[model samples]
Target: MFVEWMMGLAPGWVTAIPGLSRAAQLKALGNGVVSQQAAGAVRLLLERAHRT
Candidate 1:
């Protein structure tokens, strides 16, 4: 895919990895739910609750 190739990954690397899909890769590369994002969301919610 053009996105993967542009990101410096070899053309076949996406398919080479088991369970990896183009949609998943694109989501991850774009606005996906990463660990840091989840953690930050939880932290923010907890802080907001504490402030109430």
Candidate 2:
């Protein structure tokens, strides 16, 4: 569900979207997926964050 929402967002508007970074917003949208073992969606997001 969480992954679906994030994937639904426009790539160009991801960072522009409000309350979406630095306050663990992704972690929030991610629910427990952020902490689960082998959470691929969350891992990809963290990786993207690192690139920026």
Q: Each candidate's lDDT (Cα)?
A: 0.67, 0.53
Those runs of model 1 whose alpha carbons end farther than 4 Å from true positions after fitting are 1-32
RMSD of each predicted structure: 6.2, 13.6
Candidate 1, residues 1-52, lDDT tens digits: the string is 6765555556755545678777786775565344566788999999999999
The estimated TM-scores of all candidates read 0.41, 0.28
Q: Report how far residue 24 has shifted in candidate 2, in Å.
A: 32
Error of 2 at 21 (Å): 41
Across residues 1-52, which tens digit of lDDT does each residue of candidate 2 receive?
3453545543433345676674555554455332344567778989999999
| lDDT of prediction 1 | 0.67
TM match of model 2 to true structure: 0.28
Candidate 2 residue spans exceeding 4 A from truth: 1-38
